[model samples]
Every structure is written in structure tokens, then in C-alpha cells.
Target chain A: MKLGFLVDLNLCMGCKGCEVACKVENEVPLSSWRLRVKYIDIGTFPDSSRNFTPLRCNHCENAPCERICPVSALHYLENGIVNVDSARCIGCAGCMMACPYGAIYMDPETNTADKCTYCAHRIESGMMPACVVACPVEANIFGDIEDDSSYISRYIMEHQGGVQVRKPEKHTNPKHFYVGGGNQTLNPLAHQRIEGYGLFNNITHLKHVGDPHHGILDRFLAPFAAHKAVDNKSFMDFEQKKADSHDKSHENEGGH
Target chain B: MVEHGINATNAVVTMDAALPGIIWGWMITLNMWAKSIGTGVVLISAFLLYRHKKESMPSIRWIMPLISFVALNVFLLFTLVDLHQPLRMVNIFFHPHWTSAITVGAWMASLFTGLITLLLAIGLLDAYPDCARHNEIAKTVRANSELYEKFYPFVVFLAIPVTLYTAVIMAESSARELWQAPTELMQMLLAAFMAGSAALVMVSDKWSQEVRKDLALVLAMAVFFSFVMYMGEYFFSFKSAEAEVTLEYVHSGGEYNVQFWMAMVLGFIAPFFLAVSTMKSDNKTILRFAAILALIGLYLAKDVWLKIPQMLPLS
Candidate 1:
């Protein structure tokens, strides 16, 4: 009875169909996504390759996120989906720490944590996730893993492809699987890079929109510290000349 | 040094930060409730002692403090509920997940509260010999002195874990660079020791010299442990990028940040020095203030540790 989505990265068109579909289906506010596509650029410009990774909740069988939620706000269904109950979510973010894959997101509008629920609302009515329907490349395949004849099961058995499971040491036992994939490698912070969707963050929260890797101190303090010194070399030079010449002219007039 | 860049990509770009954020937030919310509860627990104990006028308070002594603690635990229960959709928290208990720490904490708080209540009832039974129904139950149990002595020891033991659990919950989260260390466990343990001793001293009339000495020693040990652990964690983090953010986080002196400093000064250092120097003093007010400070510090420490981590990026 375990229901989940199997995203095939090999067939993905690099279009954020699933992201858009999830937003529309869930009425998710701007910049919040149940699932997202990550683009990784590998090698040099002349001989480079771009990798796209589809990220979603694996719905781990041994969900650590489920273990840490103090109120039991999140629970696993008999069908093996690890979904959050918004009614109880106090907006604490414990599940965020427990989730190693980083699959959960907080929706600012409602101030509640969000994730791919596997479209539990629609699935109960026997409908698939909107992303599955909208995937132009047919990259997203959805069905019950328990059903032996299901497409996902067959795909897994034939190719033995599995989802990009990071931090398996954490043991969340995710149900979502990725097939035939190569994308995202390395920690984004390790490289001192931050890229959120444009206009996603309110302008107030985002002022100096740039990269953080210019300096070690800058990378760490970028969020909380003051902006760098403005480029005023020309202004300084003009001020210095005025100070010298104006002072001399004033002195001569006084003497006369 | 602030790069002023707000556009870096997330290592776990797709991770739903809100989910874990909600859960951790739930634990901290409990700490929030604990802060108020802890304050009331100590203050009420002081008031109760004042009212009883240096007499052997058979039933009323433990009853008041335990009541306050139970209320705190109940507030903790509500926090667990708050983690869910604003309305559907009942499902968690109906379909319980036993392996989760929150569930474990819930059960532990419940069991501890229940035990405290039982201890109080037994004490009450021992107090009134004419309350035949209950005295009969307690008489077969042990000496009245023995019966009188039953619960305080367990409170000490239980308080240890209860105090540490909140910190553990915060520290176990790798997400917050602040809570990721073991120092939180140390902080809780020290604060609990200080709180417990202060509580014990408050309730007693003819203080046991032996118990006083033991408490003094425990107080000293706790002070040392608390300082060592707090410093150890800081030393490690002091050089890290996360540490820089943490320093900035502290400097911001957000409500929780202010709380942490107060906890350090009033909770640990003040009482620590007092415990070392004022061990022989008859002035009880100082001890009470120390306890109050320690408890306040502990609560603030918990809040700061929990909230700081939510601000970090996993990558």
C-alpha cells in the first residue's frame, strides 16, 4: 500500500514542470516547493556537463523527521507516505534537522513546514500528483510499490535504479526513488554558494544579492553582517583635490 | 566581511527546511513553556517555604512544587500538539510513533509527573494518621520517617534526565550549528543540579548537615561541569564559519540571545561562586536568588541553542 513517486532524471527535460505542478496543485506560495529541480554544472566551460537532480521527499520508512516532531504532527500512513498534518504544525522546524536529504520546506505564507505529501489529497481520490500529470518528458512515474505489476516496481527490477539517497547513515528509509540519475554533488555551503529563486524572497529580506565566496569572512557573515565598503575611490580623490586647492586659494585670499 | 550575498544555492536545495524547522520549533516551544514553568516552580517553592514558617511541612511542601512541574509538563504536552496542523494534534497520540524522541519526552514527562503526584499522595497519607484509609496503606509500607523520605531522592534522579532531555533534543539536531554539540547536555545537567539543590534546601526546616554538604558538593560539581561543557563547545565553534554566525547570532541579542547571556551570568557563574563561597552562610535569600538565576539561565540556554540551529544551512 506504499504510494510514492519515481522520478527518472534521464528523461527530464530540465523544465521545472514538477515544481510548477506542485505549486499549482498545493496552492503553495511563491518560492516554496514540494519538489524542485537542481542544476549542477560539472567540468570546465569547454568540456562541461550540466546535471539536473529532481529533489523530493523520499518518505523514509524510518523517518527521523517523524521521530523528532514533538507534537506527532507528522506521521507515516499505512501506505508508507511520511506526510505532515498542518493542523498541528507549530512551525518549530525539528523535522528540518531530522531530514538528512533536506526534503522539507517551510511555507512563509502559512508559516508551516511543507513537503511532497505524494499528493495524499488527490491520491485518496485515486488521482496522481499534478507533477506526474504535467511532466512533459514523462519523467515522473507514480504508483503503489506493493503492486508487483506497477510501472515503478518493474522499472526498479529491470534497471535496479534507486533514488539519490544521501546520508544513508541516518537511516530515514525513503520510499521515493530516482531512476537513471546523475546530478547534484557536494554541499552547496561547502562551496559558499547560495541561490534562491528570484523575487522568491521579499526584497526586504534580500538586499545585497550576490555570491558569498569572495572571502572566508564574507561567506560566513554575509547574512548577518553589514554590507561591504562602497566603491568611493573616485569620490575620495575628488575630495582630496578640493581639500588641497580650496585651502590654498582661501589662504591666498586671506593674505591679500 | 559581510559579502552581502543572498543568492547562494542550498546544498540540499530541495530539502523542506520547514518540516524539521516545525518539529525543532515544537521542542523549543516546550522550552518556552518550561521557562515560565521553571520560574513559577522555584518562586512558588520559595513562597510555600515562607508561608510554612520553618516548620516540617508534611503534605504542603512537595505538593506545591510538584503541581507547578506538572503544569509545566502539561504545557510541554500542548507543545507536542502545537507541532501538528493548528487543529489535528490528536492523531499523533491516536496513532502513536513510539520511536520518536518527542514521544519519548512526552511519556517521560508524564511518568515523572505521575510519580511526583504519587509521592505527594503517599506523603499526605503518612502525614495524617487519622486518615485511616490511606495511613493503613502507608503503615505496612515503612516507617513514617522512611515514608516521609520517599520522594525527594527520586525527584533528584528524575530531574536529572528531565533537565537534560530538553537540551538533548536541541543538540541532536545537526541542522542548527548551535545545538549540534554535546555542551547542551552538560548545561542542562548543571542547571538541574543547581535547581534541585535549591529546591531541596527551600523545603527543609531542620536541614541535614550531611545533605547540605552533599548538595554543596553536587552544586560545586555541577558548576564545574556546566562551565567546562559550555566553554568546550565554544572553543570548538569559535573558529568555524558556523561559529562566526553563532557569534553574530549571540551579538544580535535577540530575545533568546539575551536569555543565554543572563543564564551564563546569573545561572552558572553567580551561583557557582556563591556555592563555593557562601556554603556556610545562614542567609537563605542568596541561595534562593541563585536557584532562580540558575533556572532562568537554563531556560535561556535551551532557547538559544534550539533557535540558533534553525538559522543554519545544512550544506
Candidate 2:
């Protein structure tokens, strides 16, 4: 059937609804994502623009992960969907090494390699992928690309000259296509990543133990507990004072 | 005045967390290093046996298998432990995917180990005939020298692929620009010879000086070529941007700078000089020292090469 995905960058907003929906639908563990929305700031402060790109597995025709998987845990489904059988996986992380797009992740819970399977279960049940359903702007389009009547095929036909895939030089021949996406947005290497405390950053805090509040008691009793503890009253007062001062300065500038 | 825009790069990833650093760590390094020793001994020992004949080296038959069996076990152990689903490793055998180099390598290694075990048993029986005389099976096997000869060639042939398959796996790894197959294949082969010869020198204290000299020569040649290849990549990796970025970790004052250079100097350069000196002066002490250094250096080199490439972020 040659199932394919298309993400129209033109219509996509940075809302990340699809990302959340996919996580919720798949029950993807904390800090592990089947789909992620990346924000790239382009140009100078005054003339700058931000690009929002939803990145996920491309499900290449010649999949490197499938080829490198020792146990055939990752195999192509009958409908051209690259499916993963986590039960069969030995968790060698070989697929992680072979996926150029960094789509594959070792599930912290299962300790097995997992990736976006184009929502194969949902596809078999005759439903669209969760990401496609959740995309408020209808940016994500999923259908059988081989069928000329399918939406994805028509989309491909419409954007024949403009369609792009990530890392085409790798010769993966990805079934996923992007329309109206710039190089800076599609190409991972085109930008320098900022390292700091942000969403999906600070991975040490994302350790997926069974208990949600497992280490809280231990952390509270640990060495230098008082020193590490936040003084909420003092911090709030300081923040209030800072806000007041900032308002005064802005008012003074306005007066001037 | 343009404050923010001037000289600023067009795109900066303001939000993302895709960096998975150094997934394959020291365990993989140890796996490759030990595997090299395991396969290398078989390869070099076969050559030595062919040159000197089976009758002359009575101790070598048992000793070669013993070394190979132990080293291969270590290799297999580390490989097992490194896997997140080590208990599920039986899947590789039962539900094997032949297209994967890892699958092929695993099967070959298992078969190779099994054959090495058989050889070890035969060698033990042949060496200690008095002890095993009551076991007619041992006597029958020992009597049939041709059986040993048949197994020897298989070990030799299997050793080459068992050592080289890792390179194919490395090459197959997507976006790892530093691990090109042809060069990696050469490096793996050279490493096998270097490690094999060094190991032989360490164990072959009782063997003839001529044999020792030949081992030293092999060690020297292997070191020289391997060093040249390393240097070639070190200097000229800029052809590929990703490789250049990866190599940055091993560049001067980089994270792996000291380790990489130390490996090159200690493992390859030092051994080359010592091996040549041993060849000329027939100095057993120098030969032994060089072999020790070479083995240690090989481990360090493998560690540096394995780790540095992984430092570069794929996404």
C-alpha cells in the first residue's frame, strides 16, 4: 500500500499538539518522543523568524535500522510501514546507531529500541495516525502514497517540485515528505543547538523509575538538604521587588 | 549600529533535546580488543604452524586454543553485558537476520568458539596422553592427526571474518562518518596481526629465536601500516565534514587528544621501533616489553577510536 506521511511546514504552528497527542496515544515514557516539534530561530533579533518543524521517523524504503537489526525486530510491514517488535528486540542499540535522523530511542522502561512506527496499530484499525488527527492546522497528512486517490498522493502530486526529505544524500528514500520547509528547518546540522534548561533538556531529571516520587524523600534527607532547599518566601519577595523595579525603569524611560 | 544580527549565524536551534552521547562505551572497546586477540591468535598461529610444522611446536597446539578460548569468552562476555537485553540475546541465534553484519558476526563467532573448544580438547588429550589414555575417544581423535589438520584451516578462515565483521558493523552505522568500511577493514586486520603477534611473543618464551624474530617482524609491519592509516585519517579527515567534526575530539587539545596520541606513540610507534631492534639485536627482553606496550596501547587506541566518533551529535 506504500503508506506515507507529509508535513506541510507552511500551515504548521509551534503548538506541538501532535507531539503531545502521539505521546499520550502511544503512552510514550517521559523524555522519550515518537514525534517532536523543534523551534529554530533564524537571522538577527530585529529581522528574526522562528521555524517550527515536527520531526519523526521517515520510514525509509531502504531502512538502515531494519538492515542493521540483528534479530529482525525491526521489519517492513506488508503495507510498507517500518514496524518494530519490541518483544523481539535484544536491546543492543544497533538500530539507534543506524538511524541517521535520530528517530529511534531506547525505551527507558522496556530497555528496548523504539521509534515512530507510523502508528501501525492505528493504521491496521483503519484510522489515521494520532499525529495526523491531533494536528489542529491539519499540517500532518498520512495516507497510502501509492494510491493516486489518497490525500498524501495528491499532496505529493501538488508539491512535486517543492517536496523535501531529511538527509536525501543518505539515499534512504524516505516515505515522509515535507512541503514548504526551509533547509535551516529540515537539516539538523544547519543550526547550532542551545544548551540549557529547556523543555526536553536536563535529561538527568527525566530518569524513568517506576515510582513518580521515588527519590523525593531521599533527596529531602540527603546531605546539604537545607542548602539545596528553596526558600519560597524570600524568592517570591525578591521576584516581586525585581518586577517592581523593572516596571519603574520602563515608566522612567516612557516619561523621558 | 546593528547589535544582534551582524556576524550571527542564520539558524540556531532554540528548543530541542536529541543528543544521545556515547551509547557504545568502554564495554564495546573491550569487546573489540578482546575479539582481536581471540581471532588474531588463531590467524597468526595458523601461519606459524604452517611454517614450522605441527611436530616441532608441541606446546603451541594447546596454548593457541587456550588463549583463543579465554579471550573469545571475554569478548563474548563483554558483548553480552553491553547489551541492554542481554537475556534476550538468544533471539540473535533463533530469529537471525542474515543481512545484518552483527547477526552474521555473532553466528561466526559462536561457531568459531565451538571449534576452538574442540581443538582445545584435542590438544589437551594429545599433550597429556597418559592422563587421558583411558578415554578411547581421546586416543581415537589423537591418532587421527588429519582431523586436527581439517579443523585448523577452518579456524584460520573463520578468524579473518570474525575479526573483520566488526568493521562492517561500524561501517553500516548511519551518520558515523569516521567509520568507513575499507579503512576500518584494513585497520581491523592490522590490529589482529599486531595483537596476535604481541600475544605470541608474550607466550612463546620457550620457542626458538628465529620464530620470535618472525613474530617481531609481523608485529613491526602491522604497527607501521596501522599507524600510517591512523595518521592518514588524522590529517586528512576534512574531506568529509562529519568526519572532520568527529575527528575534532581527537585533535590537539581535544577531549581524546592525549589518549589518541598516546595510543599512536605507545601502541604503534614504540612497538615498531622495539620490534625492529629485537629483529636486529635478537633482544628477547625488548621484544617482550614491546609486546606488552603494544597490547596496552592497542586497547587505548581502540577506546579512543570507538569513543571519539560518538562524541559528535547525530541530530
TM-score of each model, in listed order: 0.63, 0.88
Best candidate according to lDDT: 2
- Give a tens-digit lDDT track for model 2, residues B1-315: 443542265577777645566778888999999998999999888888768855556589889999999999999998987777677889999999999999999999999999998898888877887867778877777787566668899789989999999999998897677888999999999999998999888887788777888899999999999999999988898777778877765675888889888998999999999999999788989999999999999999999888787666555
List the global CA lDDT of all models. 0.58, 0.83
Clashes of 2: 0
When only chain A is evaluated, what TM-score does every model earn?
A: 0.71, 0.78
Expressed as tens digits, the lDDT of each residue in B250-294 for candidate 1 is 667644566666767876788777666546774456655665666
Best by DockQ: 2
Task: Provide the fnat value for model 2, as a fraction from 0 to 1.
Answer: 0.64
Please state the interface RMSD for every predicted structure, separated by commas. Answer: 9.7, 5.4
